[model samples]
Target: MIRFVVKRLWNGALTLAALVTLTFFVMRLAPGGPFSKNRKLSPEVIANIEATYHLDEPLWMQFGRFVWGLLRLDLGPSTRFRDYSVGDIIASGLPYSLTIGFWAVIVATTVGIALGVAGALRRNGFTDYAAGTIGVIGIAIPIFVIGPVMQAVFALKLSWVPVGGWNDGWRSLILPVIVLSLPNIAYISRLTRTSMIETMRENYVRTARAKGIGEWRTIWRHTLKGTLLPVIAYLGPATAAIITGSILIETIFALPGIGRHFVDAALNRDYPLVMGITLLYGGLLILFNIATDLVRAWLDPRLRHDG
Candidate 1:
């Protein structure tokens, strides 16, 4: 188990390093400078600005400086947002994203698992059909479409929640969380239903049944862990993504989250901001994936050996 965990950590470190290197170069080599959109400035002015930010330095030197700053946990200044460090921008937005993401995961996992178990148990019944329909709707409809339609009905028509803003408190979170969780819920339910059905057919499950274990005990003790394996695995990346922020959901709901900053950073060529967020996202993904692997190994000893 120690070897397994160490290996996973080592791999995550390597993945994060490569991510940083690639993102650094790609952003640098991309077509425009952060100042490209600024009001036309004199050549000397641009050169001075570039010098101040070290853009006037060679690419290799810039990369070295970035790495050095990164090692010291400094994200540096944001070019676009005057007086703001990349870290500051991210820090300000993380809480909102975390809150929405946390609740969404809870709602999605709890509801999805229940729906999936019901569907699997009832196979051809109404519960099964309803779950299937939800899965289809969640998967088939894009979030952009869903967000607007929901806002129209819930905010515009019903007036149950504000149209789009963070000032309304908890009521503001409802739409964004629901929208963000919908796809995940759909996916988890489908994965759980399939896994449950397959696990039930395994010989061990039949043996348990032949041994006359109660249905509830058989499901809770013998079946649930196996069914949850895939769901848990999927949750790693899903949780990281939603928690970090859903770009579309954040944009539609006008929520103050880091998700929009990612898009804006890329478009504005805010190198430090872009790199910071990318590293943040990449790091989260790696951490979550490692956590998922560890959890899987703990749940099923076979996975430890496999690792």
Candidate 2:
């Protein structure tokens, strides 16, 4: 287990290095430099700024310097936001994103698993039909549409919830979290239903039934052992996405999150902020992937022992 963990950590570090290299150069290659604006910088000012950021150096040399900074755990100061460094910008925005993201995943996983289990147990009955229908609706509706409809009904028409603002209490999050999780919940429900159906049909399940295992225990324990692996596999993507925060969702709700911050940064051509946000997102994604891998290994002895 120690050797396995060390190997995974080494792979993760390499992946992060590659991601940082790709992002740093891609940001550098975007049409405008950090200093580009409506009014061109005077030649002297341009030269000065370039020298100050070491942008005057050859691209390869500057890239080397950037990697070194990353190694030192310094993301450097924002060229546009005078008071902030790249790290500072990310630090400030992460909490809001995380807060909404946590509730979103909880809603998705709990509802999806319960509904899926019900759908499988009921087969073609009313519960199965209802779960399937709701899942379809959730998948069909996009977040952009869901966000407005939620804002309209919950915030505007009924006024049961505020339209936006973190300070407005947790009620402010309900609509956004629901909208964000809806699609994921739908997808997971479908997976669970299919997995449970197959697991229920297996000979082992029949043997369990013959041995007089209760119906609930047979499904919950014996059948569910196989079902969780698929769910965990799907969670890696879901985790990364939730952490990114739905930019559109954040915008529609006027939430102060990394997603909205990065959107605002793009409009303003804030290079440092843009790089910082993407890097932070990439780092989070790597961490989540590592976590998922560990979880998968833990859940399956074959995988754990094999690796």
The candidate scoring highest on lDDT is 1
List RMSD in Å for every model shown. Answer: 1.4, 2.0
Please provide, for model 2 over 1-307, each residue's C-alpha lDDT reduced to its tens digit, 9 standing for 90 to 100: 8887888778878887787678777777778776777487689989988888888999899778777877798878888776889888778878888888989888899999889989998899998898898899899988888889888998999999988878778888888888888998899899899988988889999988998879888877788978878887888868887967768888888887778766777766666677677777777777777788788888777888765
| Global local distance difference test of model 2 | 0.82
What's the distance in Å from true for residue 229, model 2? Answer: 0.7
**What TM-score goes with each of the models?**
0.96, 0.92
Highest TM-score, which number? 1
Alpha-carbon local distance difference test for all models: 0.93, 0.82
lDDT of 1 by residue, 1-307 (tens): 7888899899999999999999999888889899999999999999999999999999999999999999999989999997999999999999999999999999999989999999999998999999999999999999999999999999999999988889998999899989999998899999999999999998898888988979989988999899999999999999888899978988899988998988999999999999999999999999999999989988998887876
How many steric overlaps are in each model, in order? 0, 0
| Candidate 2, run of 10 with poorest lDDT | 266-275
In angstroms, the error of model 1 at 148 is 1.8
